[model samples]
Target chain A: MQDVHTIGKYADFAVGDIRTFAEACGVTLSVTLLSLLIGTVIGIIFGLIRCSKNKLIRFLPLIIMEPLRNSPLVVQLFLVYYGLPVMAGILLKDYTAAIITLSLNTAAFFGVLVHNSILAIPVSQWEAGYALGHGKFSTFINVIARQALRLLIPQAITLYIGQLQCSSIVSLISLRDITRVGQLLSVRTMRPFAVWGIVFGLYYLVSFPLARLADYLAKRIDYTY
Target chain B: MAMIEVKNVTKQFGDLTVLDNFSVDFDHSGVTVLIGPSGTGKSTLLRCINGLEKIDEGDILVDGLSVNNKKNLKQIRKTCGMVFQQTVIFPHMNVLDNLTMSPIKLLRMSKAEAEDKARYYLDKVGLASKEKSRHNELSGGEQQRIAIARALMMSPEALLLDEITSALDPEMTREVLNILVNLAKEGVCMLCVTHEMSFAKEVASRILFMEGGKLVCDVSKDDFFGSVREENERINKFLSFIGE
Candidate 1:
């Protein structure tokens, strides 16, 4: 393992480290996009289900969400990467397992956000729907969900960036994400600080724009009506 | 035939007993003002008719469709439109979209047709030029008028208005009341809950008085203002209190 070094000597390995870190960043971006897309869709569907009047349907998502939310992410990664093959005789490639676990974890959190946002809407909104003769599902999709969207997006985007950061946990299962690439380069070059610093910079490069976009969207949300 | 019938309905909120064995039938062609003190279940009755609140016992029929029966609930709601005490406009929608949403979504009207209809109703409510205005940007009076126009777009057999003016200033209240008066003149069956006694006297065919979750008086407008005064001390006290 490399020792932590100062930025003074980082110049030595900067150019070659750039190539490696950039490629790792590409891998991170690909997985993050795929995970966020899947997570958001699943989150919306399951979140609405979680708020459903049907007792069992509402409870069923919570059963899945509870473990995904409370347990460790690294543990979940291992369970999907290793435990699934043993239990079901169906092995997921390391990258596939990483995507699945990251997406599910993100979905669980986003789903809860969706539920809370929907709940925050006044009951009168739902009554307006009823008085308008919209059925339960239509009322939810058109009336309740539309209003909840303004409340959900700011929080969801913030959590989405958190998911982007948390995606690094996939490296524990050997998926060659930015952190994994950083680790490999760190060992080969014997300069932990330089390697990890570039990795950190790459993550910030990816995340900073999203955070700015969230703020922009939050401002625009006030003008939604 | 009655436009709406509430037959021995009971509603309880954890033993609070908001409406106890309540019953009333609203005629097919008249304005009925439900006058009551606060917490008297008048609003509950309006909500019950619209199926916004469930009755613990008995049946509410709108256009002969039962409010509680699952098969008829949708039709019942369509028959009876409700405007809330609080201004419940969808802040995310502009006035045009607000009026058109249910017509397009529930009535399956084409967007262009719904938009045209929205314009017509907005015109009726004196907001023809405010179609593109967002809900939160409008005055409270404008919002309540838009709410009325939205209900009118559904072409409900009866309208249940729960103190639609409670949040408005007097000028704003008058604007909304003016629209209601026009609807009443058009003979739209309406059950309204309000403290606006003069408007009730001016428009109501029958004035139903409720107190402590029970109907204490159901009289013709003339009788309610005239001879019916001698019938009940509580009614007289309530009328006097509100300066009727």
Candidate 2:
């Protein structure tokens, strides 16, 4: 019998592999950006609701937010991807499913950040606005929101970076993100170590610049009174 | 009618009563300085007058409009311009914008009209050149001055000052107090809460001394610093303790 343990020579990474990875990067970027855009808008609305003076209105977002925040991302992705089709007969594309899951997850975390940021401002600020003859809505828009935005920026950017990494989970749902491409490439080339190392570097490449931008913004927006 | 009337008002934080059946009437003019030990509800009274704190039982009326009625709040707040102990100028805005925002937005003044008024008040506050400056760039005194100017933009019926100079240094306090004295001389209605005895003497038309959420003494300026101080041991002790 011929020796069954003989290993085949591994294929070298080529220019074509770079093109494949680039396309995968595009998917990851789009998913992250789209989710961020949608997430932030929803998050702000949820935050305003969370900050409501009425006790009933304040807890309304928690119905949706709690599950998204408490559960595993993988489980959320699976539910949106597989469970939705079975339970609701809503046949969403894999990309759509990934975006929805990530957006909701991001919204949950971002909403909390926004609520906390608004609360962090001194009540004197609101009193000052009101005393100046502004109604509650005007005070919130003119005074509270402006101040809260400064507090929200650096933290929100950090959250965005986290969401970008979280986008990696979409690969499990067969969304062909960088991680999925890496897995495929590693199998094809028999070079798991090299493939994963490059994948890790790609994520850092995308996230490092954003982290720097957040730091710069944090410093720039600081008030010194 | 009184400028502000706190009628049978009671306020509490949980079980601790801050203001119990507190009733007072502020005249439409003159500076009335509220002096008290901390936690005596002087600030809370000011807050209640402007509809900042809701009274548990009874009514606060500003310009004859009841604070208990939600519809009256906007007018009440507009009439009572409050400056807090901690100077709070809207950050991230230029001094001009800070002064002009409320006038243009709430009062429906034209932008040009608002700017002109802002420039006038900026000059009055000795901050004409600081119009383009942000709140963070100003000294604490300048910020408080700007806060006063912001309140002035509304042409309020009364300016409710809650220890406006307490956060400032001696020099800064003098600068702020000088502005207050000028405003008082010009006959602007003010209800001030302060520990600055000299400022109170110079600017207060009437002095209100509060203790345990009740007004212990309400008298003319000279009477408060002279006979009222001599007669009321509690007032005398408070004045001594605060180094008045």
Cα lDDT of all candidates, in order?
Answer: 0.87, 0.90
For model 2, residues B1-244, the per-residue Cα lDDT tens digits are 8878889889999998999888888989899999899999999998888888888988987878999898888888888888988889888688999999998889889999999999999899898999999877899999999999999899988999998998899999999999999999999999999999998888888999898888887899999989888988989999899887
Best by DockQ: 2
Clash count for each candidate, listed in order shown: 0, 0
Clashes of 1: 0
What is the TM-score of each predicted model, taking all chains together? 0.91, 0.92
User: DockQ of every model listed?
Assistant: 0.55, 0.61
Q: Output the worst ten-in-a-row residue range by lDDT, candidate 2 chain B.
A: B84-93
Candidate 1's TM-score reads 0.91
The stretch of ten residues in a row with the least summed lDDT in candidate 2 chain A is A1-10
Tell me how far the alpha carbon of residue A110 in candidate 2 is from the true structure, in angstroms, after superposition. Answer: 1.3
Instruction: Flag regions of model 2 displaced more than 4 Å.
Output: A1-18
What's chain A's TM-score in each predicted model? 0.86, 0.92
Which pairs clash in model 1?
none
Residue A114 lDDT, candidate 2, scale 0-100 = 96
